[model samples]
Target: MSTVKKTVEVDVPVHTAYNQWTQFESFPKFMDGVEEVTQLDDRHNHWTTKIGGVQREFDTEIVDQLPDERITWRTVSGDTKQRGSVRFERVDDTHTRVELVMDVETSGPVEKVGDLIGSIDRRVKGDMERFKKYIEEHGTESGAWRGRIKPGDTSGPAL
Candidate 1:
């Protein structure tokens, strides 16, 4: 497995950043290479992404989440294998630092080569940058899922 970490500071409050992030279905609007994200339920999702001209699909589950603090997830089924988390920190009332850490493994040649060449790192950095711009430019979240879920918890607050 290879690990990648990227951080971006957005000029938005922690809640604003965190709330925007919880709108999973909106990711593809700003996240490069992401084709779509379908929210199957409050705790499950389906993702479609393309890399190196190849398309892949995956199912992910939110393993844990804390409003305004963090969200963690792992792929439950698909062509992708990864576990990751996003953390939100209050830099100030008007600033928040968002960091992402992911450990990923691939079973395909394209992804393997990309991973070996540090493309994953760069891709993640780009994603964070785009997310920062999207949130900062919008000035408000499209929607929010403020529910909370702790580690090992499956069901979060009622949607």
Candidate 2:
């Protein structure tokens, strides 16, 4: 598995940054190669992405989440195998640092080559930068789900 970690500082409060991140369906607005994201529920979503001419669809489940702190997820069933988390930290009253860490396992030769060339790392970094710009421009989140979902909880988030 190849691991990529990236961080970006946004000109928003930790609440704003974390709230925007929770709106998973809006990811495509800033995430390169992401075509669509469907939030199936509070804890699950489906993603469609095309990178390097390869198209993939996947479903991910949020295993852990805490408002204004962190959100973690892993692929439940999909064309890819990966898990990741995003953390939000307050820099002050109006600034926040967003950190992302992901572990991905290359499936085929093309993906393996891309990983070796640091393409995955670059992509993730670019995504973070874009997100910074996006949130800064919007000045607020499009929507928010402040529910908390602890690992192993199947009932749902505590809204």
Best-matching candidate per TM-score: 2
Candidate 1 residue lDDT tens string, 1-159? 999999999999999999999999999988889999999988899999987899999999998888999999999998799999999999999999999999999778888898988989999999999999999999999999988877776556543
Q: What TM-scores do the predictions have?
A: 0.96, 0.98
Q: Could you report the Cα RMSD, in angstroms, for every candidate shown?
A: 1.2, 0.6
lDDT score for residue 112 of model 2: 94
| Residue-level lDDT tens digits of model 2 in 129-151 | 99999999999999889999998
Worst 10 residues of 1 by lDDT: 150-159
